[model samples]
Target: MTIRYDLPLWRPPSEGSSLIIQSTIGCSYNHCSFCSMYTNKVFRIRPLEHIFSDIDAGARDWPQAHRVFLADGDAMSLQTESLHRILDYLHARLPRLARVSSYATPDNINRKSVKALASLKARKLSLIYLGIESGHIEILKRIAKGASPRGIARAIQRASEAGFQVSCMVILGLGGREYSERHIAATVELVNAAPPTYLSTLQLDLHRAAAPGFVPRWERHGRPFQSLNDDECLGEMARLVAGVAPARPIIFRSNHASNALSLGGILPRDKEAILRTIAQARNAADSWLRPRSLRGY
Candidate 1:
């Protein structure tokens, strides 16, 4: 059988304002239990020659590729030299490329030194999308993240201090329903240490095929997995956001389609307002659950 090495690309709802680039195809860490983002294909880094060709194509296709986003699970796994060359080529092709961003794992980020990161920033690779997931060590282990919270913190701090607009993702109710408080507390601790410029929360949507760890596809059928109800999930989010100290100008967002509540604003300034919005939704007895009509999918 011929192997297909195509990278699966996806644009979020906000992709309307951004240009998409597939720097690397698929994900290096494809074992996460709750993810199916890259299961359709194996991971592979695109050749520099091919990437440059795509850049040329993009320039011709969209003369104004203002904000570029490298796609798939993570693009930071590319060699530092190759990444730098790609960035150089992107800027050369599109002078209007204001910002470039990509998904990065803790391992990918820490693999490069602070100096290397600084060099990349100078080349216009200004943003990094990190999936910190959760701060709890057990939850990290549960997700097969293959990295510790401290490791994540160090990598994020390195990226941030090196001037990358670090946007880290947090999964609300990640610790299952039982460990929500621990998840919230530990996540807050981690965020406090490596405060990112952007923080996004994705509510857990239990998908059997998307399971990312050692758990069997049928295991969820054997033992029930606990996930927070909608109100509980929102409460957990409120606590996490409210607990964060008013220090930096962090942008908060819930960018995933699975989330019932969509919240975005500059942190500290809109924290209270966001919380009040969630509170109002809860008070109004709104249904956070997708109606049964749509749940059969």
Candidate 2:
């Protein structure tokens, strides 16, 4: 008998307690106008046996790792029993395992009962990366997020209540120039609604060919985009930081490479300083230009 793996697993830049497990192949809601990350593939979950074997292999090679991050768009799509089994296996094999993480959609989260999530949390399935994308219902619909602002809020609230640390992600320039202010305001509402322990910001990336649902219709008509300048984008981040009054200690990070200004610090205390740094950086850059990649999408 022979086994082969087709999926690719990527870890974060620096070595951390976490390791990524590519449980699913692509994104279910792959319609975001500005994204091309999973355009080439359809969403699919890996077989449970294969995933278990991979975990076993990693345990053999890197027993020191205590945190696992399920990857490839979203692992929340996995069946409830499957998720439980995976968590059980990880805890059984890696007794040192401190946490398990995954990207989750509101729809996916809503599908599972509160009891299921709490059970997973009890077994150290401790973190969730939710691409809330935008808090605006129109923006979410346009991007095919498949969930409303209310739905997103409910999902996050439930997850947090389940004893898991939630990391909610928002795209900085999601509304371009036209909707930037509304985007920011709605984001504040969204963040305030759930008040997660962590927040990450990513700037909008324009990928014309690969993303149909995400490219604005006006752009298709050859209209010039009114997207944010570096300064305005920074201002959005500043506003969100200032507005979210989470009861828990929140950690904020602008992790995406596309952002002109990278900012990270603990919330409530460092939020003001983080905004000031972004403001300074934006003033220095003056002209916020987009970056280029190897494939040139």
Candidate 3:
């Protein structure tokens, strides 16, 4: 069997080995100033029949597959009944399929009732990747994230209550130098409020295309859009790790390819070590961090 993915499919770093399927065509909300991932395509959900065919082909090719990721931004944006049918089909066709995960926006989760979410979780649609971007409302507005910090916290809490394992992500230099302190404080506040099962941080990549939109916004507001240097970026991440105190145990990771330093471990237990590692990385020369030429979106 031959399998061809929809052009420009994306999955979380942890989903590297999962079978990929496209249940949606593009992001439901693509207006974020920092993102260029789905700007080339329009938002639309794929038909159930087409999704089923893809699953059938996937099962034929990888019968031993244990994990599956629905692609093209937020698959959770699909109607509840649609998601149910897809999950049911996958379970029937792929006996080894243990979990189904997807990127989920705050709006996507908000649109579904808690009961609806629980039902999906019961059917093995277990994990959601949520991009919180920044917990500071000002930064969120600057990035056009279309969500408030309160709203994001509520959505995350709802998902947690529904028994879905949520992996929350925050961008280290999202607020640039202008709002770094407030961004870190607010992000810590939000994370502790709705404590994710996993927390990952990625450095803000000012992709060439995104620069035009993001740069001008800063200029318009008479604020300097000064991105942090490698040392400053690491320092900001260290601050975040030091400040966050989740009630539940949360796995922390700053090992994304875009990061200046790679660190991972359960929080509180490894917090001091992670901060020490960041301090060491900050003292290192620029040559030690990931070079710009080697980075990608």
Best by TM-score: 3
lDDT of 3 by residue, 1-297 (tens): 456567887788899999999999989998888788898889998878889999999999899999999998999999999999999999999998899999999999988999999999999999999999889999999888999999899999999999999999999888988899989999999999989999999888675436344563566688768887778788888989999888998999976778877789998788998888777777776756778776655
User: Runs in model 3 with CA error above 4 Å?
Assistant: 208-216, 220-222
lDDT measured at residue 187 in model 2 versus the true structure, 0 to 100: 84
Q: Model 1 over residues 1-297: C-alpha lDDT tens digits?
A: 122225446544455577777877889988777677787777887777777777788788788878888777788888888888888888899988888888888999899999999998998888888888899998888777889999999998999888998888888877877678999999999998779988888877665325355353325548556767778888888988897763587889875666667778888888889888888878876664444344311
Error of 1 at 51 (Å): 1.1
Q: Show model 2 residue runs off by greater than 4 Å.
A: 1-17, 208-224, 286-297
Q: Cα RMSD for candidate 2?
A: 3.4
With a 3 Å backbone cut-off (N, CA, C), the pairs that clash in candidate 1 are 31-212, 32-212, 33-211, 33-212, 33-213, 34-212
lDDT of 3: 0.88
Error of 1 at 206 (Å): 1.0
lDDT per residue (tens digit) for residues 1-297 in model 2: 222344544333221457666677788777666667677788888888888887887777777778888776778888878888988988777878888888788888888889988988888888888878889987777666778999999999999888888888888888778788888889888887678778888766565334565556547658666767566777888888888777766888875566666668998888778767767776667543334341132
- Stretches of model 1 off by over 4 angstroms after superposition: 1-7, 208-223, 287-297
Residues forming the 10-long window of minimal summed lDDT in candidate 2: 288-297
Ranking by TM-score: 3, 1, 2
Q: What is residue 141's positional error in candidate 2, in angstroms?
A: 1.5
Query: Whose lDDT is greatest here?
Result: 3
Evaluated at residue 254, the lDDT of candidate 3 is 75
Cα displacement (angstroms), candidate 1, residue 105, comes to: 0.5
